[model samples]
Target: MKLDEYLGVIIFTFEHMKDIPVHQLKDRANPAGFEIKYFSPGSMRKEMELLGDDVDDHYLGAHRDDHYLFFLLEKGNASLMIDFQTLPFGKNSLYYVLPGQVHHSIKNEIVYGWFIAVDTMLISTDYRNVFETQLKLQQPHLLDDKQLQQCKSILSLLLEKYDSDVKSSFYIPVVHSLLQSFIGMVACYYSQVNNTGMQLSRPLQLSQQFKQLLGRHIRTIKSPSAYAGMLNVSESYLNEALKKATGFSVSYWIAQEVVMEAKRLLYYSELNVKQIAHHLGYEDHTYFSRLFKKTANETPLEFRAQNRK
Candidate 1:
């Protein structure tokens, strides 16, 4: 996990997941774009021992994954740092890390859990909406006894399917079905906290769409009006809907997305301020520098220096 050599954020793809030293199914086919591994205290210790001097390179580092990551802890205590926020984990808890979000394991003390990573295409549209749009700030979801047991039972079955050496004609389909069931359970839990009911409102839907679009096009498209045009809504209407749904206007989120990426680049990449500004789609480096200072309260160089230290 050396961060200094990269010119941009380090992205861990599904292929990268396969090479993880702690992973159990190293010899088995992981199925396309899906991977699950069961970890316990002994297993974690053994993994660290196997890595020896290279342990630091594999664990306790920051990087972004290109797939959704889920954790279901049946016991013990753990914590994860995601996008700079420390999320605490305890007994019978569930946590999810969205794709492209920077995260690192903070601590895992005598932990027993299932770590599952799946591609975005595998997640149904409705479930993806619940994860990407409905939730404002994702935190650890503490499960009740019944919910915990249900999750455990399903994951147990999934583990069996995943670890099985026999591959039938329907193996992939069966595994996918089980994966959907597990993800549906997770989405249901999150939707309850969102309180948006079964059906999302139109304004909220628009805001969600706007956010998704902003994530994809922030570097190329910078104006609120441009986004509105692409979404077939007026700029003022988009602003109003975004304000109601997120308490922030489209412009604010656009700037935030840019600044967040800027922070990632400044800290993780070796690129200088001018190159970084250009990389982020700003032609004039001075303007980009001003925007970074205004949004992040520090010049790009200062931020890089502080974080590097």
Candidate 2:
């Protein structure tokens, strides 16, 4: 691992985890040790129970060479950073990391916390919609002890629901709701900081609705113009803002996402090539296959077989 890379696999996050064919998170390298793992509140509690070290929570760890997302639910002073930014974060305040963000520190203190392994798919969605919004809000901030306590309480409750050993359908909705509310809270705060100085009523390009839509339909829709229309923006302006920040044009960005999803479906899912093509909203399956081959350098089936082997 090097710097600013993104790794989302859970077990490989231990820093000491290997890079064999069995555990390859990606072909690329990242910063050596900074990794983030998402865990349910129940999982954190279970970890504490298993470790028998609730009082020994003060310690430092970070992503070795990649961007990570971690929400800590503990107390005491520990520096959480992602690259040039470092801020003391704990149950007292909210801390986040963007892609290529690196952080780690453990002052002599104690509290409880959980590690959550975020899905790359989710992160990709955030990248398209919330990445800049998050980056703009990037700063290690302090919260009043009371505010921090409240944040921790909310996280703890959410984790408790998520980490239960006995899985239930009901838990699914509850966890989803908790995560939505929590991220929304963070985004609201992000807006307060970035939107405060110079407000833009033109609406956030990555509107919450657009985020949800992109997350749901990126596979089917592969044009910035379509997304712009969905958000009631003209294509030219959307492209201008997107390119200004991300360097890629809007259609290109959409294609990138579509290609990624196509790879996943082609390599990970059981769907056949034609089915996968249709799933991605191409009525002309031949065109989809041609595009896939052009971008991937192998036929869909070939790519699947080679990777699976």
Task: Give lDDT for model 2.
Answer: 0.50
For 80-117, candidate 1 gives per-residue lDDT tens digits of 76655678888988988777676666565677777888
Best model number under TM-score: 1
**Which portions of model 1 show Cα errors greater than 4 Å?**
1-29, 44-47, 54-60, 134-136
What are the per-model C-alpha RMSD values against the true structure? 5.6, 12.5
In candidate 1, the residue pairs with backbone N, CA or C atoms under 3 Å apart (3 or more residues apart, or in different chains) clash, namely none
Model 2, residue 296: displacement in angstroms? 4.0
Q: Cα deviation of 234 in candidate 1 (Å)? A: 1.0
RMSD of 2: 12.5
lDDT string for model 2 (1-309, tens) is 111112232222222322211222343222222223333224344433453432322112333323335455454445543342345554544556544333344342344454443434434333324434531236654556675566566666766776554356576567656655655555555556555213433444444444445556876677777898987888887777666654656676566556655665554346777887787898888998888777767877887788655
Global CA lDDT computed for model 1: 0.73
